[model samples]
Target: MQHDQPRPRRANKSGIRQVLFNSLSFLLIFLPIVLSGFLICRRYGNVQWVFIWLFICSAVFYGAWEPRYIFLLISSILFNYFVAIQLARSKSKPLLAFGIVVNLGSLAYFKYLNFILQTWSSVLGADFQPVAITLPLGISFITFIQIAFLVDVFRNSSDDLGFPKYALFVAYFPHLIAGPIIHHKEVMSQFTNARLAAISANDVVGGIALILCGLFKKVIIADTMASYSTPAFHLAGQLQPISFFDAWGALLAFTFQIYFDFSGYSDIAIGLSRLFGVRLPVNFDSPYKATSIIDFWRRWHITLSRFLRDYLYVPLGGNRHGVLRRYSNLMIVMLLGGLWHGASWMFVIWGGLHGTYLIINHAFHFLKRKIGEQSLSVLIASRLFSLLVFPAVMLSWVFFRSESWQGAKTMLRGMLGYNGILLPERYQAVLGSLNDWVMSTLHMHTGDLVTFGSFRAVLWMILVTAFVFLLPNSQQLLSEFDRSSGLAEDGHLRSRMLAFRPTAISAVVAAGVGIVVLAAIYAGVPSEFIYFQF
Candidate 1:
C-alpha cells in the first residue's frame, strides 16, 4: 500500500483545471465547451464526426492530469479491442489468455510491482532495488473494465465490435477516473443509438439536478465527516492508544465517510453520463440500512459486486457444489475483493472479516428458516441483531482505514477498551456521586482519566448517524423522476420539503445549495474522490 499522507491533503494533481466532475472548471468551462461542440457536430448531420470528436474530448479530459498516462490508456484500449476481434474470429483460448495476461500484466507493473519487490526483499533479507513506477490514474478501474469485456468476448457474449465506440467506452470521462465499472454490454448498445447524438432539454435539467445533489453529498456531508475521521484514523496509524469512545467515534466517522465519498462520486458519474444522454449503472443504494452482510454487498458498490459474482464467484463452483464450497467461494471472492482495493495485508484481513460475517449471516438465515414463525420477542431480537451488524462492519473498517496492521491493532485495542473508558476530568465532577458509585460497583478505579475526543466531534457523529438512519438516500429521493413529466407520482417526498424535479422554485433551491457547496469548496481545497486510489 502507498504511504498515508497527512489529513486534508491536496487530492488533485497540480494543474489549472482537471477533469473532476464536481469542480467549477469542469461544470462551468469544460463541460459547456465539449457539449456545445458535440451538439453542433450533431446539428450538422455528421454522426461519424460526433463519435470522433467525443473520443478526442474524452481523451483531452483524461489527459488533462498527465499527458504521458494517456498513452497507457490508449494502448490498453487498442490492444484489447484488437485482441477481442481476434478471439471472435479464431475462437482461440490461448489468444484470450494472452489478452488477459497483457491487461493484468500492465496493471501489476504499474500498480503492484513495487509492492511485490518490497515484500520479496523483506522475505529474502536483501535489498532489492525497486524501479521508479508512477501509478497512472484509474489503472485498476480501466483494467478491470477491459478484462470484463475480454472475458465476455471469449465467452462469445460480445458480438458487437467497433474501434471508435470501444475507445470512447474506455475513455469516457464520466466514469473514467472512478467508476461504476461500466460493462461492455451495458454501454456498447447505448453508443450505437443515433438519438444520443442530439442533446435534449430534459436531459440537461435532470443532469444538472443530479450533479448538484452529488455536490451536496460530497462537499456538504462527506468532506465534513473527513474532518473528524482523518485525525482519529491518523492517531491510530501512529499506533497511539485511543479511548473506547474515541475509537467508536473514529470508526463511525469513517463508516459514513466512505459511504458518502464513493457513493457521492458514483452520483456525479451517473449524472454526468445523463448530461450526455447516457445512463450509467447505479452503484449504491443505502447500504447502511441493509439487514445482513449478504444484503450489504448487494447494495454497496453494486457494479463491483456484480463483476465479482459473475466473473470470480460463479466461475469458482459458486453454491453449485455444497454449503462448504459456497462458503469457501465467498471467502475467495471477498479476499480478492479486499486485495483489489490496495496491496495491503490489512485489506485482506478486512475482506476476511466480511467473509466471516457473510458466513454467519447465511447460517443465521438457515436457522431462522428452521425455527419458523416466532413471537414479538424473537422479531425484536432479529431487529437488534441487524442493528448490531453495523458495529461489526465498523470493526472490519478499522483494517480498511488504517495505514498498516499495527495501526489497525492499536485502534482495535482501543475499541475493546484496553484503553480506559475515561470521562473528561472537567465532566467528572458533574457526574458527582453517581460517577464514583458506578465506578466502584464496576470494580474500576477512576483517576484523572483522559477524555476520548472533543464534545463537538461526538456531536457531529451523532448528527451524522441520525441523518444516515432518518433521511432518504439520493436514489430514493429521485426515484422514478422523469424530466419531461416534471416529477413522477411514485417519486413521493418522504423526508424533505424541497422538490427533486426541475422547476422555477426547485431550480432556485438547487442553485442556492450549489452556491453554498461551491463556496465551501473554494474556501478550502477540493478533495479527491477516495475510490480513485483503487
Candidate 2:
C-alpha cells in the first residue's frame, strides 16, 4: 500500500551507471584495504583479496536488490516520523494507541513470525507452514528503534521528529547490518540540527581505530578458532571416549571465538557510527572478567540489556511486583530474548538456563538482605562464588552453539565422562595418535595425532582466553588516561590535534593497508558476517 503511493519520480539510469557509481563510492572509502589486498595477491598469489571483494560486492547487491526495498525502508522512516509529529501535536489517546500497535505489530510480524511458525509446527505437528518470507535486511533492529521512538512520542518524552533526521536514523548504513541498536531519543536531536560539514578529527580517528580492532578480532581470532571448532563439534558424535581435555579445549575455543566475533562486529558498528558523528553505546566490556553471571550480563551486550529492562522487564512488573512475580517476569523476558536470537529449541533452553541463573541470584540477594548479613566479606565471597557459577553458564553455550540436538547430547555425554565404548575401527588410528600426543604433551602417554590437533587448538584457545579476561575494558582505559591528563572536551582542539597526529595517522594508514591485504588474500571466499543468519 505504501509502495502504491504516487511519488516524485527520479530520472532512470542504466544499470551499469548505477553499479559503477556505487562501486566507485565503496572502493574509494575502502581503497586502503582494497589496494593492500591487490598488492599482496600479486606478490604471493594468495586469493584472500578476491574473497573480500566478492563479499563486499555481495553486500552491495543485497542493499541494491529490488530497489523497491529501499522504498520500504524509506516508508518505515516516514511512518515513524509522521507518527511522532502527530503525537507531539495532539494528546489524543486513540492516536497514541494506534501508533503503539502499528509500530510494534509490524516489528513482530516481520521479525518473529517465522520463528513462531517453526516453533509451533515442531510442537503441534500442524500443517501450518507459512509462505516463505524473506526478512528485509536490518528489519529487526530498525523496527525496534522505531517502536522506541513511538513510545517516547506517546510519553511526551520527545517532540515531533523531522523527516530527514528520522530517515538518517533508520537508514544509517554502518549500524544497518547488525547493530548497537540506536534509540530515537538518543539520535534524533543530534541529526536534526547537525552541521553536515562539522567533521571532528577525533571522531574520525577513534572510528578508524575501533573498526581496525574489530576487523583484527574477526579475521585473525574468531575465524581461526572457528576453523577447528566447527570440525570438532561436527564430529562430536563420532568422537567416542572423547578425551576430556580435547572436548574442553574445543568448547573453550568456540566460547572465545564467538565472544570476539560478536564483540568485534559491535565495535566496528560503533566506530562506523562515530565516523558519521554519532556516538553509539558500548556493547561489551570484558564480560569474561565478570565474577558472576549477573555481572557478566551487565558487561555483555549492554544496550540489549537496557532494551530488555526498559521495554520488557519494567512493563512486565519488574521488581515492583512481589518476588515471585519478579522472578516470573525475568524468566519470561529471558525466554523471549532467547527466542529472539533464533527459532531453535536450543536457544529456548539457553534462555531458560540463564533465567534460572538470574532467579537463583535474586533469591540469594534477597536472603542476604533479609538476614541483614551485609558484611563486606560476605559480599566479596558472594561475588567470588558467582565466578564459580559462571562456568556452568558457559557450558550451556555448548547447546546454544551445537548444530543438532544429537550433537549437543554427545558433547554433554563426553563432558560427563562418557568414554565411547563402541567407536568405529576406522577412527582407531586417528584416535590412538591423538591420545598419545595428548599424553606426551601432558607427560601422560602417547596416543593419537588426531588428538594432537585438538591439543594445539586448545593451546591457542588458552592464549586467547587469557587475553580476553586480562585486557582492560575500553571504558576503563579511557577513564585512566583521562585522569592522568584531562578529559578530552567534546569537539575540543586538543582532541582533534591528538587524532590527526603523525603516529595516529600512520597507524590508520597501516590498518587500511592491512585490511586491503587480508581482503585480497581471501578474495575467492564469500564469507558473510556470521550474525546475518540471525
Give each model a TM-score: 0.90, 0.75
lDDT of each: 0.76, 0.60
Error of 2 at 83 (Å): 2.7
- The numbered model that scores best in TM-score is 1
Candidate 2 lDDT over 1-534, as tens digits, reads 000101111113332222221123333545445445534543454233333442343345336534556666767777777877887888777876787687767756766676567666767876665656655666667767777777777777763365544665666655665566777666545432132235466666666666666766766676666765655565774544454545665677677767877777776777665655567777787777776677778877777788888878998989896989999999998898776665566777778888888898788777778766677766886867667765866787886776556667777775664642222234345667575555445443323422226445547776787767655444343332233111223353433443323366667775785566367334522222445434
lDDT of 1 by residue, 172-265 (tens): 8888877889887776576644666555776777677778888888777887777767776778778788777667777777788888888788
What are the clashing pairs of model 1?
none
